[model samples]
Structures are given as structure tokens and as C-alpha cells.
Target: MTLPTPPRLTLTPEELRALTTLYTTDGAWTVEEGRRHCDRLDVLLAAGVLMPVQTLLGMMYQLSPQGRLQVFGTKDLAHSLRRQQDRAYLRLCLQHYGWTRTTPHTTRHLTNYLGGRQLIEVMTDGGPALVGGQMTSGGYRGLAIKEIGERLRSPALHDRFQVILFTPRPSMGQTAAAPFANFLTLIPLVPAGEPDIHYGVPTRAQYVPPPPPWDTDFEWDTPHITASMAVRLRRDDSPLPRSSVAILCEPRSARIARFKADLTMDLAIADTQLRRHYGLSAEDIEGVPFVDAVLRPMHANTSLEVQTAVYLRSATLAYRNDAALMHLVGVGEMRRHLNVVYPSQWTVSTAGRHRIEEPDALWHRGAFDVAVEYDTGEYKLHHVLRKLDGFASRGLRGPVWGVPSARRAAFLQGEVGSRLMEPPLVTQWWLPETPFMV
Candidate 1:
């Protein structure tokens, strides 16, 4: 009952031009470009090569995965496609925590004392602020309370701006917390969410403390405190079950944007580390994108990377335990490896056309690797069986799944493997401890 998919042909110059126009313009084909390349664009649309995404700027055209692969060639396309996905993922996560980016990221030059370097500035629902610089080899040094106080004392500006920090430790520890509790807020970007697997080890569960009592009489001076007050007063008292650490963190608008940026960097570094650990050199990883190449099957079919990026935060929190040696391999890498070794069976037509055959993720731990397919309540038993069957044919063992609940975990093990361990939930690292805001 299956029809053979047509051979994916190389992109002609005209086709490549169309894809480039969309790609370079950040997936937005201005009306002028559209008119000039209308014929080619039309062809692409008919062939399901371009996906139209509507934005405030007007209509934008994004290359479908097939379009990217065919036009840019997988090598070059991987970087562009993964970056596109990363930005989209960051924006969505920011929105989830109530931040609507008010302005496009802008760069401002600071004085020589700060090295005259360009700093990235972002405006959100909270306020206009300067984003922290990218993490360096020394790791992220959080924005200090004294630094904010100094900026407040700056003669050029008065006390008008807020300093948002993107550090793993979102809270100013007890020593600093009490003093600057009203001055600044710490929002943890724990990627814990309802669908995350945070229960692998009992100790891995980030303790969720009882909600802080809303104080009507308390003075709310800083934006952070004010925002926390609003959220606490607005929500119901009933506690929700713990999952991703993000659940415990306050969802301030600024926190959301900062979290988005911070986690994006963390995931990027994790991919590089995994690749190098697995013996992949920089030359070997040239065109392979981070999420697509390393975080592959997880980010391929669904928005799992964007949704559970905080999972890395949880994984890091548990690194002292079993997750220390864990690494996530992308499905593209697996496919490429399979094709290079057995091109007759794993060519583009056969491997690229089918998602069922593609494992959601390749979980590598020492010598025992498992092909993973996440069960987010979207697949039936037959669907899962087929994925397992496909992996088996490739001399692979499982699409070792990470289910959402204990009940589902039990069912899967009964049907899959008895030794399978439950994936950990995405719990916050600073659980049971109140952040600056709440």
C-alpha cells in the first residue's frame, strides 16, 4: 500500500535563488521580491517546499525541511535551519512565560571602560534593559547587585534602567538576596514542564516549596517584586504537580526573555561537548546544526527542544548522579552514518521520506545506545511498534521512549524493556528556596 517517493533532485539555479531570497530575508519575502520571483515561489509552494508564516512585519516565507535540504544541501542547510529553529523556539518559550519582545534586538556601544563593545539590548513587557554578554570560557558571571547600583549612580542616565542577568543561579544567594531582594529579581530558567521526565532518581525531583503568602501591605518597589505580586495574587492557591523546574520559577516577562537566551546558549554548548566527546571534530560538524545534528530526533519532528530545553538545566542539576556521562545524538547523524555505511538501503529517498523510521533521539550512555522516540500522548501502540521495528531492521535496538507518567512508563516497559529507566523530570535546581521575587 506504499507508494515510492520521487527521487529528491538537486535544486536548479532558479530554485536555489528562490530559497535564498526567503532564507536571507529571515524567511520573509518582501512583496517586491515576491513579484520578481513569483513563478519560482509559486512552484515551490505547489511542491510543498515553502511554509508561509504570517508575522507583524507581513507575510514571511520559510523553507520547509525538504526545501532546506534540497536547496542548501544538508551540509549548509543544517546551520541555517537549526538557527531558525532556535530563534523560533526562544521566542515561543519567552511568550509562554508572558514576555512579548517589544523591540528587535539592538546593539549599543558603551564607553571604553566597558571596552566600547556593542551590547545587545532587548525591550520586553518588564522594561528596556541591556542583555548580558555571551558566556565565556570562564562561565557566566552574573550581574552583581553592586553593578546595578553603580549603573543607577551613572550621571548620564539617573536610575532609569534595569540590569537583567542570565546565570544558572537565578537567585542572589541568601547573603545577597536579603539586601537586594527589592532591588532586583532572580528568575530561574529551569526547563521543567508538565511533559518532562524528572523522576528518574528520587533525589532528582526538585522540591517545590509552598507558595509564598501574598502580602497586600508589603511595599512593591522594583518591577520584579511588583510582577511577582501580580502573578501570586492572580493565580489560585491549589498546587500543581511538579515536572520541569520552570514550573517553580516565577514567569516574569523579563525572566522569560532572559531564560530563553540563557538556555539557548546552554543547549548549544551541550551539543558541542557531546559532539567532541563522541569523537566528532569541528571539521566533521561543519554544516551539521546543533539541534538538528546533536539534539536531532528530539527537535526534528516536534517542538520538544524548544519546549523542554529546560530539561538540560535539570540534567545538569543531576550531573553529579547518573546523568554525568549522558549525551544526546541527533537523528540526522544516525541517518548519515547509516547511509554512508549502507547507501543502498539508507539513501535520501528511503530515509528522508519517512518520519516513522526516524527515531526521535539517539540516547548514548557508554556503549549501550538506545534509539528514542518520545511518547507525548501522540502515538498509539502500533505507531510505537512500527518505530521499534524500523530500528530493529537497521540493527538498532529500541526507540527507547521517555513517557510522561508512571502509568505510561509501566505500560511501555511491559511492552519494551524491563531495565529501562524513567527519564528525570525537569525540576528547578533551586527548589524549596524562594527566589528574590517570591
Candidate 2:
């Protein structure tokens, strides 16, 4: 039997405050936190707002996904550990080999660079790409510059292959004054990891009948030679197939602080074959969070923007080879890449300021114009209502409002949904690669 869900939630002001507080928090709350809301917990749970888990530290409460959507306008947790750039990039790799290729059967260690750490090689079509892993991300403050040099200085990497190191980044715009990130790449003269190059006389085959130009292959570069040594010795000939390299460093951001709330997630691999072959768990596929140390974080009005970009790239690439999805997004005369479109793209530019009004995303190509606005439920409700009102007043099919949760949808419907001649579509903010052609 289904419990009847009320069309409108009738909550005390304290309950609303608790919901807002939990929604914005990066970590979970202890049962001690339950004290203040003790009386109201049952009500919120019945309404699908508060989800209390009996943690090792006693009972803790986290906002339910639906409640988060209702509050934030989307279910995507702001503190999701999966959103790290390096990890996300690796996810892109798993979606397709072009992004990266990992070989668990032949795991290798990097001398000087990866130190004692052993990670599966990250490969590319052109050649060897990068070997990425976590570096010390000692919170946001300790993670600035000092942490990287000690890690980045392998002094032993190839010229063509980069020594890729990843760490959790400080918040956006935090490192403008920080120096250019030090890094290197090397494509070996021989097949990657096959170090045939040696300190040799000019008579050797490597320099035998030198080309019109000297065989650049045997330049005897310091980085390359050292890289060869690592490649020569990097292998873990041990028969055990443990997919471990201390997978991911915990980011100190308060947002994802409680990732360890689930201990079983540790020691997991994202590759299915690796797990089955290695006799590991099918329970989880958590990837390592690793990206170039040089990269920086940006404002997250769009942490989803980064995710969006990756999703679009992956989806479009699939359409190219997969017959069933060839015209999945219908990128006809319009640009295939994502670029911000302006009032000029719309035929009805005569609307003045409304044309200047910003859209979170737009699907415009001749009559297929649908401008979208994403509300995380972060803005003042009135401001959102006013923005939507002005947008709808323009009288196009959209200016679709991409909301996060059900309550937000209800609120929009209760308020703006009825106010406009054609209020924009209020749906979950999980955008498709393309603005879904509604």
C-alpha cells in the first residue's frame, strides 16, 4: 500500500530552516544535531525530507536526494566526491579509450615520479599519455604550491609522456598568482616501456646509418633515460591482481567531507573486467581522482558545466560510431561544440533587455529555439520568480526552467507556473547532452 503524499507540504518554519541548513551543508549531521529538530524528524521523514542513517558515530542525517532536489532544484550533491576533475576525466576515459586506456594486466610503477606508487598505465592512441595518481592535497590551505614540487620533481620522465599528478584543487580563483605548473611529457624513441636505448657507440642500430638528420631517438636526454629506467623496472611481476594505488586522496572541502561515511566504497575499481578478472567486488566501481597538478578549480555555478562538457563530448563521440544514436542530438546547421549564444542567435532580438537576459543553456537553430535557466534553488525565490516572469513575458516556447527538486517544481508551479501565459517547463536540472527537444 502506498502512503498518500500530500500535494503541498505543510511544515513549521523550523522544519523549513532545518531543510535549508541540511541542503547547504557539505557533511552529515550527528544524532546530536537531531536534538533541535527532535520533534519534527518524524514529520520530515514522512515527507521524504530527512534521511537518517545509523552511522558508526551514532545516527546521522543527510538530506534525501528528492528533498535535495526539492530544495536545491537538482539531486546532484554539491559535495559529491565523484565530481573531481581528474576523476571525472578518468570517467570520460572509461566511457571511451580515446580519453584514456588502462591496462591492469601489466601494471607498472614510475621511478622518481610515482615514487613507490604503482598505477595502471594511462594510454592514448598517439602513444603513451600520462600516469596519473593522487598527490598530497592537505586541505585547501596546505595544498597551494609547496605540495606539488616535491611530487612533480621526478627528474625522470619521458619527453613525450607527461608525469601527470592529480590532487584536490583549492576553490576557484585561489591560485592566480601561483606560478605556471611544472610538468613534462615524452613519447619514447622505442615502443612505450620498452627501453632498448642504451649508452652506446654510434655503430649501434639506434644510430647505425643515421638519417639525413641524426636519429633524434637516441638523444640521451636525462628525463627520457630516467623514464626508461622506470619503465624498465616499473612492472609489479607479482601474480596478485590487487587494483590498489591508494585510490583517491580525500578532498578537505567541507562539501565532500563525509565521503568516508561509507567504508565499503574504499578499495574499489571502476573497470568491470578488472574486477571480474581479479576476483574483486562487483559491488562498486569507484575511480581514482587524479588530474594534472597544474590545473585549477573554477566557480561551480557549473560544476555541472564541466560534467556537461564531458557528457556532451562522450555522447557526440558515441553518435559518430553507434548507428542507433547517429542523430541523437540533431546538430544540423548549428555548431556541434558548446559555445555561449547571444541575442543575435535568436530571430526575435527586437525584445530588447529580454534578449540580454542570460540563459543557463540554449538550444537555438532556426525555429528550434529553447533557452533554459537552471535553478539550484540557491537564489532568492522571488528573484527566480521575477526572472522567470520576465523570461516568459518574452513569449517564446522556453526559457525552460531546469529545477533541482520536486518541492521547487511544486513551488514554481504553485507560483510562476500559473502566473505566465506559458511559464517555461519546470523539470529536473539534469540536462541532456543536448537541450532535450521539448
Candidate 1 per-residue lDDT, tens place, 28-133, comes to 3433445566566666665656655322122335566566667665523143333343233233334445654344343232221233322234464556554332
Per-residue lDDT tens digits for candidate 2, residues 1-438, read: 223643334666766676776545324444545556547676666666665532112234566655565666785535532223223323322333344554655323333354444233565454443444321121122233234334554543334344433322223213621432444321111101111222320100111122334444543312211333233332643111121111111112211222222111211111221221221221221232211111111112323321111111111121111111111211110111122223344221211113335444355657666655545555576777666655556654465554445566666667667553344333321222111111
Local error of candidate 2 at 366, Å? Answer: 3.7
Error of 1 at 235 (Å): 72
**Global lDDT of each candidate:** 0.37, 0.34
Provide TM-scores for the models: 0.26, 0.24
lDDT of 2: 0.34
Q: Best-fitting candidate, measured by lDDT?
A: 1
Candidate 2, superposed: residue stretches over 4 Å from native: 1-175, 178-356, 365-369, 389-397, 404-406, 418-438
Distance from true location, Cα of 247 in model 2, Å: 37
Question: Which portions of model 1 miss their true places by more than 4 Å?
Answer: 1-67, 71-86, 102-120, 131-159, 165-186, 190-438
